[model samples]
Target: PRSEVGDLIVIFRAGAYGASASPQSFLGHPPPIELTIDGDEIL
Candidate 1:
């Protein structure tokens, strides 16, 4: 565990409790980035 302590990882599809799911703007949250990973057209 010490060897991987500095590494940064992202967990996707973990649950529906994500901020971008719903009621985000009402709580003064910024808009999340929408990614379109179509081949090299990753936007």
Candidate 2:
């Protein structure tokens, strides 16, 4: 498989118990966490 390299967007609630939509990217691969607020992605 081609090595997945590049940016990614992860969505979840501000709460600690919210499950991440992109768990594979957020919890796996050691990706950096970027927060999204009010349907807007953090630049």
Candidate 3:
């Protein structure tokens, strides 16, 4: 995958730990969306 080294990628389940540990703000990334569920709603 060397040809795709700089392409955008999605790292599944990174939020479990990476989000908290990664210096996203310092890296200039916006805050990640948080999800919450209650009954039949997703907030």
Candidate 4:
């Protein structure tokens, strides 16, 4: 398990509801862009 080139991997699952019950336009898929970081300021 080794990664390079921008390395930022996090896959710890227990019921990870990524994309919030994703059904993106009922499968047409195109609606998942909501980020709001405060520390480094990306809001």
Candidate 4 regions with alpha-carbon error over 4 angstroms: 1-16, 20-26
Q: Write the per-residue lDDT of candidate 2 for residues 1-43, one digit (tens) a residue.
A: 4446674545455565444444555546764555546645553
Task: List all candidate RMSDs to the true structure.
Answer: 5.8, 7.2, 6.4, 11.7
When summed lDDT is taken over every stretch of 10 residues in candidate 3, the lowest stretch is: 1-10
Worst 10 residues of 2 by lDDT: 13-22
Q: Pick the lDDT winner.
A: 4
Pick by TM-score: 3 or 4, better one: 3
Steric overlap count per candidate: 0, 0, 0, 0
Clashing pairs in 4: none
What is the C-alpha lDDT profile of model 1 across 1-43, one tens digit per residue? Answer: 4548556445555466554576767668776554434567875
Best-fitting candidate, scored by TM-score: 1
What TM-score does each of the candidates earn?
0.32, 0.26, 0.29, 0.24
Name the TM-score of candidate 3: 0.29
Judged by lDDT against the true structure, how good is candidate 4?
0.60
Off by over 4 Å in 2: 1-3, 17-31, 41-43
For model 3, the superposed segments whose C-alpha errors exceed 4 Å read: 1-26
